[model samples]
Target: MKNVKKPIAEELDLFEKKFAENVRSRNPMLDRIMRFIIRRKGKQMRPMFVFLAAKISGTVTEATYRASSLIELLHTATLVHDDVVDDANLRRNFFSINALWKNKVAVLVGDYLLSKGLLLSLDNDDFRILKIVSTAVKEMSEGELLQMEKTRKLDIKEEVYFEIIRSKTASLLASACAAGAWSATGDEEKTRLFHSFGEKIGISFQIKDDLFDYGHDNIGKPTGIDIKEKKMTLPLIYTLQQADDSTKRRIIYIVKNHNKDKQKVNEVIELVKQSGGIAYAREKMLAYQQEAMALLHQFPESEARTAMEELVQYVTERRY
Candidate 1:
C-alpha cells in the first residue's frame, strides 16, 4: 500500500482533511459518532483508487477530491447498514456501530452519511460523478437482496454468484474509478475503461476474501464465517458443483440447517479444500487480476500506472 500511494500522497493527504470536514455535523451526538468513524477508518483503498485513476487518466482536480469523498461516504454508509443487516458485532476488529450505539442510531447514521454524500455532489453540480455512484449504490442494494434470496434456497450458480459480487462489492469500486476518470479527464471512453478495470479488480478482491474463509491461519476474520452465514462463496459453490449426488445433498443440508455448528462449518471448509475449490478460485482470481492489469496498461507508462498495478497486486496478495 505504501508503494501504491506514492504517486498520489499529497492528493490523499488533502483528501483526508476534506473528507473529515465533509462528515462533520452540528449535532453533538452525530458529531461524536462521526469522529469515532474517522478515527477507526480503514486503509482508504477506495480513495486511493479514485486518485490513482484520476492521475492515470489526467490530473487530480478538486472535483477528483470530491469524487473520492463521495465514494468513501457511500462505502461507509453501506458498511454501517450491512452490520445491522448481518447482526455483526465487530468491524475491523472494533465494535460495530450497531453494537456500540444500537441499530436505530446506526441506521440513522448510515442515512446521514448517505444524504451528506448526495448533497456534496448536488451542491457542486457533479452530476456525472453522482450518477456513476448512484448507479453503484442501486446495484449494491440489488446484489445484496439477491444474495439474501439465494442464500435461503442455496441455489446460487456460478453466474449468479458473479452477478451478486459484481453488484454487491465490485459496483462501488467501479464507480470510484469511473467518477475519478470523469472528474479528471471528462472523457467517457477513459471513464468506461477504468470502470471495467475496477470491476475486474473488485471481483478478484472478493474472491481473495472468500479464499480467506477456508484458511486456517490467524487472519483478520474468523474462518468459515461465510459458511456459518450460509453465504455461498466461490470455493463452496465449486465444491458443491463437483460433489456426487449424496455428498452434494449432505453439504447443502449442512449449510442450510447446521450452519451455526462449528464442526459442520469446518466440514464444509474441508470439502472445499479437498475438491480443489480453493485452487480453482485462485485461478479465477488471477485471471481477473491479469485482465485488470491489461486494461490499466492501456493508460501508458507512468508512476500512477505503476502504483495502480501495485494496488492490483496488493488486493490479490493481502493477508487479511
Candidate 2:
C-alpha cells in the first residue's frame, strides 16, 4: 500500500501533517483519543485517491489537503462506529477504540471525529467537498442498514446487491476522487468522470473482498466470517441465484442454523465454489476493473494516471 502511493509520497506526508493538526483538540481526553487514532490509522487509501485525483486533473492545492483530510476524518469516524456496531474487539491487529475505551467513549469519539470533518470543510468554505462527503456518508449509512435488513431474509437480488455494495463501500471512494477533482479544478465534467471511475474501482475492490471469504487464499482474515455473520456476499448471492429451490433452502438452512459449525461452514463454502459462484464473481470484478481502467485511459497520460491504474490493479490483486 505504501509503495502504491509513492507517486504522491510528498503530498501524502503533507496530508498526514494536516490530518494530525486538524484532529488535535484542547480537551485532554479527546486529544489523547485523537492521537491514538492517528497512530493506528489504516492504509489511507481514500486520501490517496483524493491526492491522485487532484494530481491527475489539476494542481494539488490547500483545498486538496482539506478535502483529503475530510475524507479521512469521516472514514475514521465510520470505522470507529462500525467497531461499536459489530462488537469488534480489534482493528488492524490493534485493540479497537470500543474495546479499549468502551462503547460510550468510542461513540463520542466517533461523533467528535465527524464534527471535526464537518468543521474542516465549513472553516475552509469547501462546500463542494462537504456536499460530496455528506452524500457519501448518507449512502454508506443506507447501505449498512439495507444490508442488515436483508441479512436475516437473505434474499438479495443481483441489482440490489450492487446497490448495497455501491452505497456501503464504493460511495466514499467515489466522493474522495470527486472531491479531489473538484478541489483541483472545479471542472464538473472531470469530477463526474473520476467519480464514476472511483465507483467502478470500489465495486471491484469489494468483490475481491467477497472472493476472499470463499478461498483458502491468505487474506489475513479468516474465510467464512461473512457466512458466520449470515451476510450474503456476491459469491453466495450468485450461488443462490443458480441453485434449485431445495439447494437454496439447504444452503440458507446451513447459514442460519449451522453457521457456527466449522464443518457446515466449510461444506457451504465448498458448495459455493462448486456452483460457479466464485467464477461469476471474478468475472464481475474483472468487468468493473476493466471499466475503471477504460475511464482512466480516457484521461491524458501522466504518472498520476498510471498510478491510478496501478491502484485498480492492486484492488484486484491484493491478497489482504
Candidate 3:
C-alpha cells in the first residue's frame, strides 16, 4: 500500500470532455441519461487500466483514449441496466437511472452504450476488439441471468457462484484489459495475459465488495443491501458451506425469508463470522490479487507497470 499511486483527478476531466464529444451526436433522450450518469463518473478505473496498459506498451494514442472511453461507456450501460434489474434506487449516493428515468429508459440507455461501443471499436476496424467486447457482454449478461436464476435460492453451490462472478463481473474487466492490449499492440499473447490479469482483479474486486455486504464499518454502500435484496453473495455462500447443520438451517431460513429484521441481520452476521466466511473470502481475494500482479510482471517494468500494480493494490485495499 505504501507504493500506491495517487490518482490524477484531472484524468477524469479529460474523460468527461472526451465522453461529451463522443455522445454529442446522439439523440437528446439517450444523451440525457448519458450525461446524467457521467456527471457523477466515479473513479474511472476501467479506463485507467486501458490508458495505463497502452502507456506501458509505449502505445499511448487516440486509440487508447477512445478505447478507454468506450470501456467507461460500456460499464455505465451495464450499471444502468443492472439498476433496472435489481430495482435499485440509490447508486453513488444519487438516484439510479431506473429510479429516475424508469425501467424502459434504463434499458435503452444500456443499448445505446452497446451501440456506441461497437461504433468506437470500428474506429480502428479491429475485429479483434469487437470480438473481445462482444464476448464480455455475452458473459456479463449470462452471469446476470445465472445470478437471477439462483436468486434467493439457499442451495446455491460454490462452483456455480464462481461461474457467476467470472462471467458477470470478471468478463468486462478482462475485456477492458484485452481490448486495451489489442488496441495498442495487437499482441494476442500479451493481451491474453492482461485479460487474465483483469479477470482475476475483477473477481477479487467483487469478493471484496461482497465481503463488505456484511461489514459493520462503512465499507461502501449500506452493508446489507444485498441481503435486503435477497442476494446471496460470497461471504454468505461460504458461511452456508461451513456452518453446522443447525446453523446452516438458520442461515437458509433467514435468507429464504429475505429477512431485514435487525435480529436476522445480526444472525447472518454472526454466522458469517463463526463460519469464517469473511476470512475465507479475504484469502481468495488475496490469491487473486497475487495472480493479477503476476500477470503484469510479464511486461518487464515501466511507469505503466507501476500504475497497473498500484491499481491492483488500490482495488485490494479500497474501503468501498
Candidate 4:
C-alpha cells in the first residue's frame, strides 16, 4: 500500500481532506461515528483506484476528488450495513459501529451516509457518476439477496457464484474506475475500458479473498467461518462439482447440519483441501489477474499505470 501510495501522494492527501469534509455533520453522534470510522479505516484501496484510473485517463481534477469521496462514502455505508447484518462486533480490530452504538443507530447512520453520497452527485450534477454507482448499488443488493437464497440450499452453480461475486464485490470497483475516467476526460469509450479493467481485477480480488477462507492466516475472522455461516465460496463450489456423491453428501451434511461443530468444520476444510478446491480457485484467480493486467497494458506506460499494476499484484498477493 505504501508503494501504491507513493505516486499519488499529493492527490491522495487532497482526496482524504475532501472525504473528511464530505462526511462532516453537525449531529454529535453521527460526527463521533464518522470520526471513529476515519480512525479505523482500512487501506483506502477504492480511492486509490479512482485516482490511478483518473491519472491513466487524464489529469486529476475537483471531480476526481469528489469521485473518490463518493466511492468511500458508499463503501463505508455498505460496511456499516454489513456489520449490522452479520451481527458483527468488530471491524478492523475496532468495535464496530453497531456494537458500540447499537443496531438502530448504526442502521440510521448507514442510511444517512448513503443519502449523502446520492446528494453529492446530484448537487454536483455528476449524472454519469450517479448512474454508474446506482447500477452498482442495485447489483450489490441483488447479489446479496441471491446469496442469501442460495445459502439455504447450498446449491450455488459456478456461473451463479461468479455472478454473485461480480455483483457484490466487483460492481463498486467498476464504478470507481468508470467514474474516475469520466471525471478526467468524459470520454465514454475510455470510461468503459477502465470499467472493464476494474471488473476483471475486482473478480480476481474477490476470488483471492475467497481463497483466504480456506487458510489459517489470522485475517480477523477465524478459518472456516464461511462454512459456519453456510456461505458458499468459489473454492467450495468448485470442489463440490468434482466430488463423488458420497463425498458431496458428507460435505453438505457438515455444512448444513454441523456447521457450529469446529471439528466438523475442520474435517470439511481438509476435504476441500484434498479435493483440490484451493488449487482450482487459485488458477481462476490468477487468470483473472492476468486478464486485468492485459487491459492495463492497453494504456501507454506511465507512473499511474505502473502503480495500477502494483495494486493488482497486491490484491492477489495479500495474505489478509
Q: lDDT of all the models against the reference? A: 0.94, 0.92, 0.79, 0.90
| lDDT agreement of model 3 with the native | 0.79
lDDT of 2: 0.92
Measured by lDDT, the strongest candidate is: 1
lDDT of 2 by residue, 201-296 (tens): 999989998999976355553479899999899999999999999999999999999999999999889989899998899999999999888888
Ranking by lDDT: 1, 2, 4, 3
Top-TM-score candidate index = 2
Pairs in clash, predicted candidate 4: none
After TM-score superposition, what is the CA distance of residue 297 in candidate 3 from its true location, in Å? Answer: 1.4
The sequence of per-residue lDDT tens digits that candidate 4 reaches over residues 193-284 is 99999998999999888888887334543489799999999889988999999999999999999999999998988888888888899999
RMSD of 2: 1.3
TM-score of 1: 0.97
Model 3 lDDT per residue over 64-168, tens place:
667777788788888888888779998899999888888987898788887887887787676777788789989998998888889846567888988999999
Give the 10-residue window scoring lowest on summed lDDT in candidate 4: 213-222
TM-score of each: 0.97, 0.97, 0.90, 0.97
Clashes of each: 0, 0, 0, 0
TM-score of 2: 0.97
